[model samples]
Target chain A: MTTELSLVADIGGTNTRLALSAAGVVLHDTVRRFQNEGRQLNDILDEYLAECCPDTKPHSACFALAGPISGDTGRMTNLAWTIHAPEIATRTSANRCILINDLQAQGYALPALAPDQLTPVLSAERDIRAPRLVVGLGTGYNAAFVLPIESGVLVPAAEAGHASLPAHTADGRKVVDWLLANLGQAQVEDALSGTGFAHIHAALHGEKATPPALLARCEDGEAKALKTLEVAIELLGGVVGDLALIFLPRGGIYLTGGFGQALTPWLRQPHLQTVFHDAFAAKGKISAIMQDFALSVIGDDFAALEGCALRVAQN
Target chain B: MTTELSLVADIGGTNTRLALSAAGVVLHDTVRRFQNEGRQLNDILDEYLAECCPDTKPHSACFALAGPISGDTGRMTNLAWTIHAPEIATRTSANRCILINDLQAQGYALPALAPDQLTPVLSAERDIRAPRLVVGLGTGYNAAFVLPIESGVLVPAAEAGHASLPAHTADGRKVVDWLLANLGQAQVEDALSGTGFAHIHAALHGEKATPPALLARCEDGEAKALKTLEVAIELLGGVVGDLALIFLPRGGIYLTGGFGQALTPWLRQPHLQTVFHDAFAAKGKISAIMQDFALSVIGDDFAALEGCALRVAQN
Candidate 1:
């Protein structure tokens, strides 16, 4: 069961974060963030294991990937990393290994999240029993809804952000078309992610810039950068509004990751609220009831990891 | 629980569908459909019991309602009838009395649905374990998603159709606004229900008319009703598209009732697909994966009643 020690790792494109813990709940001695540019994850894991636990072999390994999980292997969406479970388990000699879509793993952690952990963005009576909608606005945009089941004792999560971000307005249409023409990436994530900043920047000002540059410019009150983020945030709100209507997560709608912190402050912002509220208002009373649920962003970097442990705990 | 026969009735505005099932599964002998336009439901039940099972004093009763269910009593959204649960339970001497939003009951039935019972509108390898989304386009529009919890389930039902029906285009905006002003009902359900026909008819002809009359005209290939249904259907598609993005129902999306049937045969029809698909396609891969979940209109008229029975069985 790996009760003594379990390996919990979150592998993104540029940085691979690994920590050894007891059931992925409480961190033990091994927490390290390393760049994956030079070595494969197994080589990294092997080096870490021999250095950290020379005599003992862990029984269970749970991983969260920053990409879509196909079978037992997942290729990192943003990095040149290809991960397969069997190879890693065979090499690591771990008894059990499972890889879950990061968003799903994040969702699994919703139940265990301390109430204090959530900074309420929308203050409704946080009914712990209602379905909770969890979304991640991270390196790449994605979302998951953790819905209460069986009389509110359990919650199942899902990837919801990839669901289209159709432009419902002239401005939205402009943004979408701009992304298509400039970014040339296929989906909403292309425009919703950090990379989306470059596309948005180029669309608004006729030249591309990285997310950091865009954020820096916006912080410095650059007109073009602020305009780009303004539109992007509105679009994000509209999509979140659409999801709230679809899931009716009475428990609440949660925005996770650093991106959420960067964006959620714009929660009550007029442009974003208009798009968010109007999207559901088109559905009728569900819009009215949306006021019944809380909206917030979970500001934890290790949410997915915590969720991975939480998911395993369920099993 | 009572071993004696209990009634599980599904009441709509027109016909009352009743099932005298032991648990939640329907028993052939207990299926009863009674026309209730001229009489009260209590009267109808009394008569049915007299003719069908005079000696049986039922134990408890549950009903699936087509209108919003908040308080104890109920009134049919499209009919002039009152259903007081406690009053009925007391009179009928049924030991238990309960009412559920029809869509919530439908959500419960998804895990138990047979393949043959569902006709695929779109083919997707559904994650059966994932949360399943259920939508009903009946007299009033609503939706619910059944979230699979640790071992139990949560049925978060929503009156989704009324939330907001944001117009996606100039044409959509014009049609929706015109219908709203002319129909004197701006709510999504007002312009998008059976009543929506009259609104569409008025929009097409610049005057209001009855739905039945409009349908009759359309039956003879009248362009007015056909055109109106097209606009209404387009709006309906847009609403569904919004839902597709909101829930990310990768498990599968089930559409129930006559309106869904009328639309299903038309998902492939011209502008309809664009109106619906574009809404979901707004995001990209989520749109691609959504195609994996088959969209279907349940063929069985008895689905909700069967679903109610299935709900009892699960318990």
Candidate 2:
């Protein structure tokens, strides 16, 4: 039997990564990246087809976009592009096409991700039958609850990062106050994303420092940068623990995105662990529930692409 | 054809409310209240059957308990009784038996509740296809997300009240600090439930007062009592907005329980509306989403009994 290829793309604000998948596995050699520089989605698709896979045509396609999807159409909130799946299907000569929200795609990716692609941050036993959580913290923050339903699993997306930020300690309160004064709001994403790290650094150092620079300085033994990271990680842990209580994801909490990857090294810190457990122990059995979760960071960058492939199989 | 009856009970920490339902409608007259005074759930069932409906034997039974239920048994967190559904079914001469968490019963009650059973709090238009939320704020606090799945709807329960509390204002922070010092941590339930109201009254008045007395004083133009209610409502609005962003419950947030009913009179207060809208307006479409939701308070006391009969029908 011959392999049938399907097209998949994980479209974000700045970049759109497209790939070909056969039998739910993304083809490593068929991967391509296209900058989203004010160009229409159709134009990008046309260029990709013409240059990347000159002769072969995919039978189906799934575009996981960074926007709110309404029926067959989607408009990227961060980028100036609108996508309609039917239009893409007609243009690409494909039998079927689908559009899913980015966070939903991330949720779909969880089941398909391999063990090697994951790094256990806070190791603990997991209840395989229970729901799991996927949290994205890069340029922005979002979460998805992967629920097991009768027909199949349902991934309900969450825009929790836009919710209010919580402050636990005195210094944490000051940071929250600073965020309210500077950003006019203290949403969790305001303190938990890439730019959020810069804001925290600015709040501490009285000047902005890039997230990477701050991390490097912290690694190089700079007390100020180290303190910023400590506070940031503690806040992240606190928020994650709070969300854990909300969903009761006994399967685990998986952290994704570049910022999450950066925090992988700090997961074992006593401050982070203490904050997470303390957040739950404040209540009743929630502390025991917290102990049941296995925390991990998605090490693979292609997980969302794999998720897009999974969507194609579903269709 | 004669309608078949099902025995249902909403077992709380202090009381067990038993009733009979036929074809999804609860028989109000058959309802019986039994105090749960360190007795087994089977003993209560026997007493309820002997007193309430001596001649009629129900086909099935569903027990909605205020505790964590596993497989066939449940142990009440607030009381000493351990309940086994299979044994109860055998003793009651019922063919089938099931157990559901009290909050899950509240979730099932949403679709069965009539308009008169609900008091509209926020009268905005709603998107029926989107998910709805059921928030319980009585002796304890919890929430459930009623999501529409492929086979049917799934009401995934949330222990949100146990999550970390958010404080956006100085007075809110003071409440947080007071809770942290007194309770060792500040969970949302610590400031949102009936006991939470008493705690807030104590924090503000330098002495504790019953929730009923505090509300009466607030209505009677007592300055301290009024201030406490204002802060509590603002905090409640803030947390509700946060949950809204998480679920985007366009079907709206339905507040339930005795405390929630008490707050219905204050729903139109500018302080509550301003705080709720401001929480969402800080972001993009969340404010619009908030506007789309039609908030209401569930007023039916027999909702769980009706929900139990619905469960029997599904089985």
- For candidate 1, the per-residue lDDT at A39 reads 85
- For all candidates, the clash counts are 25, 0
Q: List pairs with backbone clashes in candidate 2.
A: none
Model 2 alpha-carbon drift over 4 Å, by segment? A1-6, A22-29, A50-60, A93-96, A269-285, B1-5, B21-30, B50-59, B93-96, B269-286
Chain B TM-score, one value per candidate, order as shown: 0.84, 0.91
Query: Deviation in angstroms for A145 in model 1?
Result: 1.6
lDDT of 1 by residue, B226-266 (tens): 77767776666556655565555667888876666656655
TM-scores, in order shown?
0.81, 0.92
Which parts of model 1 are misplaced by more than 4 Å?
A: A1-4, A150-159, A166-192, A195-210, A217-233, A268-287, B1-6, B34-60, B70-98, B111-119, B123-131, B146-154, B163-251, B264-291
* Alpha-carbon lDDT, every model: 0.67, 0.81
Interface RMSD list for the candidates: 5.2, 1.9
Q: In model 1, state the lDDT of residue A84.
A: 86
